[model samples]
Structure formats: structure tokens, C-alpha cells
Target: MLKMKSTCERCRAALTLSEQAYICSYECTFCPDCTEALSQRCPNCQGDLVLRPPRTRSPTEAPSLGFKAKLEDFLYRA
Candidate 1:
């Protein structure tokens, strides 16, 4: 399964399970807003931000949607 990371690399904003993030060649993931601000390209690889498949989570597993949560809980809160 793809690792569902919690934050955007550039802005360090939270990336939620529901939102789509652009993964670069190095697999660096960032939120759509960040991607757009970054010019729809990965600063590291200068690659495109295509829709990546959502990470598989079991029904019993609660996903940590940091961006979706209250802003205070995030490291670089969105």
C-alpha cells in the first residue's frame, strides 16, 4: 500500500486522505494547493501531480486526516 503521508513537503501543510496529492519522482507528496502554488510541478523532480490512489486502510483503522482536523493538531497546519 502507498504510504499516506500527513503533510505537504513544500509548505508543510497537512494532506488529508480525501484530498489528492501530487507525488514526485522521489515520491514526495504535497497538497493540491501547494502543488498549484508550486506551479503544478514538483520542485524536487519538476514532475507532474497526477491523482495517486488512496492508501488502503482497514475499516477498523481510523485514518488520521490531519488537514481535515482542527488546525492546532498539525505540525505545519493547513
Candidate 2:
């Protein structure tokens, strides 16, 4: 269900599930390059960044449509 959290918050790069995106506890998303530059820390929330779980795709959903929808649910739970 974790889809479309792929755009880099810092540079607006078009990131994909295959490319990997880092996200903080507050759901601040960044590309791998930006994450490395920031030392895996989210500047906005000042939290540790980690690899966002790749979104699970539905068989009937178009990939692009699904990718364009940002995720705001089920992302922050211990």
C-alpha cells in the first residue's frame, strides 16, 4: 500500500521503487543521492531516514497512476 512516495523532497527527482527512496519518521521523502548527502537525516523533521518499503502493486491498477498517488497511511508504526 506504500505507493508514490518516490519524489525527492530536496531535488524533485523522479524516483522509482527500484531506485529506492529514504523517508523519515514524519514521512519526508528523498532520493538516495539526497539521503546520502544529508547523511540519512531528514532536515525538515530532523529524524533518521530509512529506506521506504517498496509499494505493493495491485494487479488491476496502472503503474503510473499508482505511482502518482502519494502515500500518507500505514507508514509510521513500530
User: What's the C-alpha lDDT at position 2 in model 2?
Assistant: 46
Q: In candidate 2, residue 55 scores what lDDT?
A: 56
Top lDDT model? 2
Quote each prediction's TM-score.
0.59, 0.64
Q: Tell me model 1's lDDT, rounded to 2 decimals.
A: 0.73
- List of clashing residue pairs for candidate 1: none
The sequence of per-residue lDDT tens digits that candidate 1 reaches over residues 9-53 is 888888777667888766788888887788878888778876666
lDDT of 2 by residue, 1-78 (tens): 444565898999997766688988778889989999999989998899998877555434655344334342334331
lDDT of 1 at 70: 50
Q: What do the candidate models score in CA lDDT, each in turn?
A: 0.73, 0.77
